[model samples]
Target: MAEIVNLRQARKQKARDEKLRVAEQNRALHGRSKAERQRDRLIADKAEKFVASHRLDPSGKDEQ
Candidate 1:
């Protein structure tokens, strides 16, 4: 015995499944937690501060 599948419903279900797979991949690529985000932010802030400490610019350049 064979069951007839509704074409429209099957297509929609496949689309939904594909979307979930892609969303999962994205979550994996990006860190998935608050702690991870905070850690990255701290690293960036420290790097910026280090750069600023080593940087020098003419004060009048910004006024132009």
Candidate 2:
């Protein structure tokens, strides 16, 4: 025999779960300090520059 469930309660629980998920994500993204964020930005920028420097040009001529 299948157990009966209340649709209204289930819907409310689902909404609560979704809200909690979003809140957790927001905390992770916004919890960092200014210095920590700046450090991460600097590291990302350095990695981007490094990759760009090593990338090859599609055309035959080398870009000055």
Candidate 3:
């Protein structure tokens, strides 16, 4: 026999989950403008170069 669920609680949980999902989607859509994306890309590129400059050499020959 299957356990019984409280219908009202189940409905409320479903509603809450749906609301959270919609809010997340809306946030992503309106979160960043084009200029923001460009700025993020620039910042990320700079960070990458900074980290790469401090890295050790690969020191292994390719097996190709």
Candidate 4:
């Protein structure tokens, strides 16, 4: 005996699975924890301060 399957339901299920897979990948790539965000912010702040400290003034005098 041959089994009968609904093609429309199968297509929808496949699409749903693909969507979930993509969503999971996106979460892994783009999601960040609170601690991670804080660490990134701290690193950026340090870099900005370091650059500012080393930057020369427009009048060619080192700004203190």
Candidate 5:
């Protein structure tokens, strides 16, 4: 005798597996660690400050 499987249960299980697969793929592509995000933010802030410091004043005069 051969074993029998339920079609509905099989379909639901397949769907769940497919959903998990896509979730994992998305996480690999878009997920970032908190430390990584913080480091990138710090780098951006430093670059912005450097540019602002080097920018020339159009009026050629310091404003109080």
Candidate 6:
């Protein structure tokens, strides 16, 4: 004997699972806190400054 299956319930369950997967992806993309964002920005700024300080000028004159 074959088991009875409900097509409507199966469709709804599939939709719910798809929604959950999209929500999880969205959270990963935009889930950073304000402090975390600021910290990342600060680190990037510091790195840029460090790189600039180490760069040499194209002209013969050197500025420290």
- The most accurate candidate by TM-score is 5
Evaluate residue 20 in candidate 6 and report its C-alpha lDDT on the 0 to 100 scale: 99
| Candidate 6: tens digits of C-alpha lDDT, residues 39-63 | 9999999998887777786454677
Residue 47 in model 2: lDDT: 100
The sequence of per-residue lDDT tens digits that candidate 2 reaches over residues 1-64 is: 9999999999999999999999999998888889998999999999988877777863446867
Error of 5 at 40 (Å): 0.5
List model 4 lDDT by residue over 1-64, tens digit each: 8899899999999999999999999999999999999999999999988887787763556656
For model 4, what is the C-alpha lDDT against the true structure?
Answer: 0.90
RMSD of 3: 9.9
Reference-based lDDT, residue 26, model 6 = 94
Q: What would the per-residue lDDT of candidate 3 be over residues 1-64, giving only the tens digit for each residue?
A: 9999999999999999999999999998888888999999999999988877776655334555
Scored by lDDT, the top model is 5
TM-score of each: 0.62, 0.49, 0.48, 0.68, 0.78, 0.55
**What is candidate 3's CA lDDT for residue 11?**
100
When summed lDDT is taken over every stretch of 10 residues in candidate 6, the lowest stretch is 52-61
**What's the C-alpha lDDT at position 29 in model 4?**
98
Which residues of candidate 1, in runs, are more than 4 Å off? 47-64
Q: Which 10 consecutive positions of candidate 5 have the poorest summed lDDT?
A: 52-61
lDDT of 1 by residue, 1-64 (tens): 8999999999999999999999999988974699888998999999988877776753324544
Which pairs clash (backbone N, Cα, C closer than 3 Å) in model 6?
Answer: none
Q: lDDT values of the candidates?
A: 0.85, 0.90, 0.88, 0.90, 0.92, 0.90
Clashing pairs in 1: none
User: How many residue pairs of model 6 clash at the backbone?
Assistant: 0
Candidate 3: minimum summed lDDT over ten consecutive residues — where?
Answer: 55-64
